[model samples]
Target: MIAGLFETHLKVADLKRSEHFYGEVLGLELAHRDETRPITFYWLGGRGEAMLGLWEEAPENIQRQHFAFRSTVPEVLRAPAWLRERGLTPRNFLNDGTDQPMVFAWTPAIAIYFTDPDGHSLEFIAMLGGGPRPELGVISLEEWQSKL
Candidate 1:
């Protein structure tokens, strides 16, 4: 029987910088790290949930990755400004290179997008009420919530 997800490993150009971003800036707990061998692991929430390991490597060989963390409605709402204060630009999931957090009608989740130091697209999402998937375009969380 399937239990749950364990962790994910990602390659980063600089372990120290990535460590600071994932740890201090993002507020994830550093579960384990080894600067000598140059690999670091962090927990999404304390020692539970799941862990993420950042491995040092050359930038050219490191293909960017994307992932989303589950969050609550209030947290998702406050994320854009909070992330911006830390020097990260939050964008919409459209990858349009613009800062526009959105709400999807299909699965009904509020998602805020941003790129990490490694240029990996990341997202924070909160599940809301649902409906049939729209053909295209996303709406603001305020607009999505107001309709209900």
Candidate 2:
């Protein structure tokens, strides 16, 4: 049976710089690190919901990717400002031409997008309550089939 997800890893360009950015700037705690293996790991949250892992880059190209973290309003507010203070100005917190906080319709979540020092796109999102959840709502079997 599937239990839960423990962690995720990323191949960072510079271990030193990535450590400084994720550990110091992002306020993530350094849990375990091995200079010999040249890999570092950071623990996130009290219950370890997520982990920040860094690995040495190989000769192959490192493809840039994006990831999002679920957070509260306070965290959402702090993220943009924090990025700005560090001179990493985001393209925009909210989508361009919209006052909303870079959100999607029918989902009560706000997302913020920015790139890391190595040009990896990262996002932080906050979920709001009272939004439509398919599992929580009832639907007729015939209606569902018809829509599909």
lDDT for each residue of candidate 1 in 1-148, tens digit (9 for 90 to 100): 8687779988999888999899899999889887578799999755887999999999888998989887988888788899999998988877687666688877778899888899988899988766745643487766776776
Q: Per-model C-alpha lDDT, please?
A: 0.84, 0.66
- Superposed on all Cα atoms, the candidates' RMSDs to the truth, in angstroms, are 2.2, 7.7
Could you give me the TM-score of model 1 versus the true structure? 0.87
lDDT of 2 at 79: 70
Q: Which tens-of-lDDT digit does each residue in 12-106 have in candidate 2?
A: 77888989988887878898899689789988764466677888696265678777766775676567676778777654343463222443323
Identify the leading candidate in terms of TM-score: 1
> lDDT at 106 for candidate 1?
73
Off by over 4 Å in 2: 1-4, 93-100, 133-148
Model 2: how far residue 88 lies from native, Å: 1.5
Give all TM-scores, in the order shown: 0.87, 0.75
